[model samples]
Target: MAIVSEALTVEELYYNYPDGTAALRGLSFKLMPGESVALAGPNGSGKSTLLLHLNGLLRPSRGRIAVGGKPLDAAHQAFARRYVGLVFQNPEDQLFMPTVGEDVAFGPQNLGLAGEKLRERVRSVLDQVGLEPARFLERQSFNLSIGEKKRVALAGVLAMEPEVLVLDEPSAGLDPRSRRRLIRLLKDLPQTQLVATHDLDLALEICSRTLIVEQGRLVAEGPSEQILSDRVLLETHGLELPLCLMGRPDR
Candidate 1:
């Protein structure tokens, strides 16, 4: 087998809140370019904390985190932000601009792209996410539906053209059709994706690898099939195995 190059790497990462309550405890993992990996865990399992560290939003209290082979710190934070595009679990948190176009253009504009190039980037991303550029460009974010808002949020991150896309619960509270559409869009994106979600079926459908986190610690890491099929392990970690794979003699 060929070795994949690392897009994100965490080395013994540990993080704590203001009150000194640790949220992440010595967690370590590597994300390769063009790879889609799912992060599965219950609430307060450090999933969000780990995601924040990928883009330098929250520095590790101990150990180190590197994005695209560079250390995540003040010196490399700007570079890390450009390389890692994070789509928040709530679209409301990500969409703050008066207009959808402006929100999508925010990242690229900050990066110094202007004129026709910036417009092209914004339009391209919006279209890629299944939003009609002409229709959404002038629309206010607050007026859009939940699904549209999610797409716009994704477009904003896509406009940045980051090497890695870190998504936190991308499929939360959406209708079945919307969920499927989002999953399809994610599957089609040509970027490395680290999806932190409670949707095991989504993970099994879209991710090649899986990482199980529990109580601020990583308990298991392996191919999605093996990890998802391990009923005992899943139950112990407060997770459930996908039904289709629950009882198959061949598996």
Candidate 2:
């Protein structure tokens, strides 16, 4: 089958941290609409750095990033933000309002939605994340469990109705049950997902394609099954094959 073009495209991307540490070098990829992909790699492998560039949090030190065929620019930054909603690795970083509903409402409100429409959007997104609208809406953000907070953060992003969802280490630090819940929720969502994670199991379950990076450069790109099944290649880049794939009967 021929590959469809992309809803978001990154070409020849290069970026360096303020301390002069290069994070991404000549990275290029395209995310087709409704496609799920995992960006897997080790620490300092530039996963977070790449996510930052997707929504214009960090402009490229070199090369270009385009959303829906329009190059990223000052005027188009707002449009890009609306199109690509980034859910940070830490829920605290993304959710700041006193109440869960307020936090979820922040993004839509900023987009100038108000009154009934804003309430409907907030309630709808919270429900979508499996958080009961009435029960969670008035609750304080700090009182919720880590998993609940993560879902709330996602609800906040979903409220924006983004075409592309960028997630950074979404399953990190969750208990088994919470992790399972998150995986199920992720699988159910209809939006295109660009997930940055070290969880190969989750990646295998939810993503069709995998991009492996090491030390600021993309080392592997292919179908998730092929990339994740190659134990030697994964080990070379300081990664591991998913346990289920390690002792497969066919292998």
Candidate 3:
């Protein structure tokens, strides 16, 4: 039987900013193929800083990271970027191209896709993200609503066909309907996912496992239902029980 490699791994990771502020401290975790995991923490708990290291956007000050079992070093960083798709909390950081189509095409275009192949890639991912390609293709990206822009940003990442998806605060700044739509879309995607979010309900709905980080270190981990239902555990980490569990007798 062929062995399956882990989709992502981090070992003894540490990162400190130029100002000497420590962002990550000996943090470590792993994601197997097709696993959906949630990273829960309070503000300044280093979730964003840790995520930037996944694709080599921010190199770790110490320790190791691997994408699809390949070391994320100077040589493999490019591969890591292509293998791991990261969606920022803010759509503005991602949607910078003139039109929606151009923004979505940026990654694959850089990968050497052109003409019909590139067009199809853009069209396919837009459809994946629930956007109508014909209507969105030529529209100026700056004109889309918050929900549309977030989906467009996700489409841009999806066009790369990455093996893993890393999203930071994916549900932030969304209306209830838009949030539901985004949740549905994420549930349908097949990539291994590491979602950093404060939305416990979304975490329970989408992620099978949950890891809690505190003061730049992993403090707890377990099945989503088991971990998310612990009121004391949630409160200790500056989180609350999932809304779905709020009224339960045990909650």
Candidate 4:
């Protein structure tokens, strides 16, 4: 039998800013293929910093990161992005194109796809995000609501057809209905997922495994149900248990 290659691997990663402020301290973890994992932590717990490393947006000051068993290096960064797609928490940061279709087409266009291929790619990703091609294609991105913008931003990344999807606080600033729809969409995707979020309920619903970080260190890592149920653990890391799980006996 063949062994399953890890989708992502980070070993003893350490990152420090120019001011000498350490953001990641010896952080290490592994994510398997087709797995959905949660990165749960308070603000400034290195969640965002760690995510930057996943797609080579930020280089590690020390240690190593491998995507599909290949080590991440300056030359290989572009290649890595082909397999690892990252979406920021704020849709506004990603949507600068005049039209929604243009934004979704950006990544593939950069990869040398054009004309009929590019149009089809844009149409397909819009459909994937629950946006009709004809209606949303020509729509001005800036005029859309926050929920619509988020979906459009996601469609842009999804068009890249990555093997692993890394999302930072995906459920942030979303309405209940939008949040539920986002959750359903994420659950349906076949790509390996690593989501950084403070929303315990979102983590519980979408991720099977949970890794908690605090003060740039991994505080806990385990099954989502096991980790989230421990009130003391959550409080220790400046987090609160989800209200829905608050009175449940299992929790």
- Number of backbone-clashing residue pairs for each candidate, in the order shown: 0, 0, 0, 0
- Which pairs clash inside model 1? none
Q: Which regions of candidate 3 fall more than 4 Å away from where they truly are?
A: none
TM-score for candidate 2: 0.93
Superposed by TM-score, candidate 4 places the C-alpha of residue 149 at a distance from the truth, in angstroms, of: 2.0
Among all windows of 10 consecutive residues in model 2, the one with the lowest summed lDDT is 242-251
Evaluated against the true structure, the overall lDDT of model 3 is 0.93
**lDDT of predicted model 1:** 0.90
Pitting candidate 2 against candidate 4, the one with the higher TM-score is: 4
Regions more than 4 Å wrong, model 1: 1-5, 246-251
Ranked by lDDT, top first: 3, 4, 2, 1
For residues 171-242, could you state the per-residue lDDT of candidate 1 as single tens digits?
Answer: 887778778888898898889999999999999999999999998899999999889888888999999888
**Top lDDT model:** 3
Candidate 3 weakest ten by summed lDDT: 173-182
Which tens-of-lDDT digit does each residue in 63-98 have in candidate 2?
Answer: 899986678889899889999999998898888999
Error of 2 at 86 (Å): 0.3
Q: Per-residue error at 170 for model 2, in Å?
A: 1.2
Taking all chains together, each candidate's TM-score versus the true structure is: 0.92, 0.93, 0.95, 0.94
The segments of candidate 2 whose C-alpha lies over 4 angstroms from its true place after superposition are: 1-5, 249-251
Candidate 1 weakest ten by summed lDDT: 242-251
Model 4 stretches with alpha carbons more than 4 Å out? 249-251
